[model samples]
Target: MSPRRRRTEEFTSYYGRPILKEPTWEALDIAGYIFAGGLAGASSILAAGAQHTGRPRLERAAKLTAITAISASVAALVHDLGRPERFLNMLRVAKPTSPMSVGSWILSVYGPLAGASAAADVLGIFPRAGKAAGIGAGIAGSAVATYTAVLVSDTAVPTWHDAHAVMPFVFAGSAAASAGGIGAALSPLAEAGPARRMAIGGAAVETAMSFAMERSGRLSAETFHQGRAGTLLRLSKALTVGGAVGIALGGRSSRAVSAVGGLAVAAGSALLRFGIFEAGRASTLDPKYVVVPQRERLAARQEEPAKADTMG
Candidate 1:
């Protein structure tokens, strides 16, 4: 008789159940929080820059926008929690190893500074204090802009976890783009030149980082190319590209064109955040994603000893 052929066994989960816990965050609340936090963070920096340059209108606009966005983000975050009052517990301890803890502290510090700065601008109180608060807000805002990536990546979600290295760059770029877009839309064309330049640079960085993320060899990269997540991300890319082109060609000449471009960039940033959130959720629903990578890792570990032995 011919030698029996060996059959390869496939890894399987019980009843095909997911091997990982699904994210419990609501799409609207959590994703909105992400967008608003980023916008607020970047806007704070813009406000400080405008202040230094003596652009009163742009400074005022950015300060107000930053305050509003951060307040909204805080509200959204509270609304997302199962126990809203428990949110304060995040501030109880400062754990450098915990991204969530770090983020809470960042927001707490940024919020007061941002609010004080905006209030000072509106009430014309304590010019030096306002400048100091604005400066502090700008510094803290940089942390706020990028720390959300750390928050998400700290989770078990495959796509978010695997993309940790590049996720901060992606978030920072998107934050800058959104802030620039808002600045461009709200400020005069003459006062908005810096915003326009910031938008272009931010969009370029955001687009390149996103492309690199999707091309990374992680299996989770597939999440960006299929399903609802795919559709939104694809639309985000298209809008971002189109908006960048419009800004490049007409940003200097037409306020209307610049406003439209800015709006597009803002919309793209929102969509990208929502899409990433959805993709991470989708990844958890699949057993293969959870099981396969882990199995491969285990196999690789097992092979290491043999390779060491052979080398020795």
Candidate 2:
């Protein structure tokens, strides 16, 4: 060889410019929308279970929480879109390939059911109809909880796209944590058994999944541990774990402690969403996040042919 080839120490775009455009979505609106949607979806499932178990206080609280969270979620989405009717316009057609379309449909269907169930529960009218609506809402709510993960992961954002495998599980766990949190906070200690258990289980899952995602060695995974994203994620994990512990220890003894723990869990869930959003955006801003992965792939492809030649 005339000269030994040296691997580049770092990859960069021309003039050190970013290769990918950052997402235009506002962090507050989108992150809040995600948090609320997850809270609503998971709360509906809890509501259905509470209904079946004859925990009327838990059931009614969960139902009300579901409707209110979903309403806030939809309002945030509409506000971001800058038009309320734009949401309705999406219902005109169904597109299976589009996460936005599917999510819109899910929201449309779940919203009415949640609203009807909550309204009937509060008004003490149409008990049978309300039960039916609650069941229907619970079914739709499962999709509502996890679809946002798919929606974000489907985008070109490196951090989000790379975490696609774990994102849904993360979202699902977070949703359950938030729902259980609210229920435990609002319901009496005797009726709050299920909520406390749910919060603990959800917290465990959320923590484990997030840790796995971060350690999976994806290039963009670094974004999660750097800067604002890092701060938020770390705090979220602490609060979630601490909250779960508090719920486990104090739920049976003290109402104030249980409520505080529940609030902490809910706050942690919200921060997790915001942290993930910030991580994705941060990845887009850095040229290395885009360039390095592409270079690694190109190197791998080049090595594949050489390996084949050696075998020959």
Candidate 3:
């Protein structure tokens, strides 16, 4: 009998180099920007809601969170750009077609509004102006929370680009969860109701979207399931779920529990952003994550034409 032959698939590149260049973004800076931006944006929204509902403490905490987080987010972005002027240059042109341009504009508008709102809350001056600014910040914050998703997905990274459909939803959920966490942690027990609800709801949405994105079974999705990215994502999910549960159970009663749970949720949100950033970078390291998907698409297109010819 002839010896049996086994065939294995291997992905290689010219000189074993990656097909795509890895992103030059610093992990800490960019990932921190993503986390802080989401947190700030959602906190602005929560602040408006709290103000409308007459929750004074919650409103103040949320406002403070919005301004602080956004400030940190801007700092991270500027640091990553290597020059503060680079950020300002992005604002000179408003290109609706470019996520970066739109995002730059959003940050510029949202920052002042958030600062005014926070200043009003802290300094107890210009209450009327602050309220109006808070509302404006809320409106802009909506975009700030999810715009990063669009910004990153607009890139050539396989994992991020491929997951575009669900990326915004994931970011929105993460933002809400983190904002809720901060609110709950800072607010008194009597005023923690809304924060707890937000935390639970956000966690649910984030968890569902994360699962859906990963379960798509695409080759790139594998980056999210292996290595450091995988570990970080897994931990993020656990902390988010645990934090949500803790808030649900003890948030209404124990101040200590609520604070711990809220912090956990925020930590999880940060880790989720980091994990996603890592996954996108990891996707660029291996040629298979890029080449295989393109080859598959090409094969499918060729098959479609052959089928059409046969039908004709």
Candidate 4:
């Protein structure tokens, strides 16, 4: 392949611009990601709460959120594809190296299982089935929440590659925090202990991961640390801190505080994805990141051949 084509493949994007210039999407995509995160995160919080207390409210919230999360995951995915017909094409290959592919498969499993659990809850029939569905939803929702970290990490960009190991936890935390924020706003303050804890914990995790992703120096680390990403990083820290504090202070039922905190965590999570997307593109734009890493691989591959020939 020509150097230009090769560079494009490694870097990402149609050209120098972002794939979604305005980041505009159908309502489904927008709501789906949020719902998915909320569902999974909320489900986790409820599950945790269930361990301590068996309030019917918490259980109801968890079941509803998990189902909603799964539904949104599916909707967001379909919207992401831009065409209902293109869905199956995504599964043509199971490339371990491809984050999008891996994420798709994960979401596919998480979506249906979680939705079924919620559906069971909606219907009064089959108490046994509802329990089974809830378990399935919990498992699937958690996966949907965490795997996004790997999705970002799987990219060839400097910022993402360097922080691969930590991103999953970060995503998981952010998702949970988002759920907690929502629950706190809607649920009674006294009963919101689980939600508050989850939100605060999630915020902390996201803040740390965002810092780590920015601090790494592989290639586009600067990209993440300057300009838009820099702004985002600072914003994430502020929001996470603010949100965590707000949740921990026992005032979550306040509409204003909860709204701000929820928006903050959600923004942080979304920006994380956006920043990574841009950073990957930037890393690929320059020939050095691609050439440098691949060259090292080739060199390592060549050493084995040379050593074998020498021995022979």
Reference-based lDDT, residue 312, model 2: 100
**lDDT value for model 3:** 0.92
lDDT by residue for model 3 (1-312), tens: 311111104557789898889999999999999999999999999999998899999999999999999999999999999999999999888899999999999999999999999999899999999999999999999999999999999998999999999999999999999999999999999987998899889988999999998877777887899899999999999999999999999889999999999999988999999999999999999887777778778888989989999999
lDDT of 2 at 310: 100
lDDT of 2: 0.92
Clashing pairs in 4: 11-284
Steric collisions counted per model: 0, 0, 0, 1
Off by over 4 Å in 3: 1-9
Query: What are the per-residue Cα lDDT tens digits for candidate 4 across 1-312?
Result: 866346546664345444322333443464346446544645644543542475556566666766665566666767777786676787777877776787677666766665565566567667677666566656656666777667656654555666787767666766777776666555555566676676777778777766665665454466676666567567667766876786566355575676566556555555555555555555544555555556667888989989999999
- lDDT tens digits, residues 1-312, model 2? 211112223455688778899888898889999999999999999999999999999999999999999999999999999999998899999999999999999999999999999999999999999999999999999999999999999998999999999999999999999999999999999898898888988999999999998887887998899999999999999999999999998877888988999989989999999999999999998887766778779989999999999999
Error of 1 at 214 (Å): 1.0
Best by TM-score: 3
- All models: lDDT? 0.90, 0.92, 0.92, 0.62
Better of 1 and 4 by TM-score: 1
Compared with the true structure, model 3 gives a TM-score of 0.96
TM-score of decoy 4: 0.72
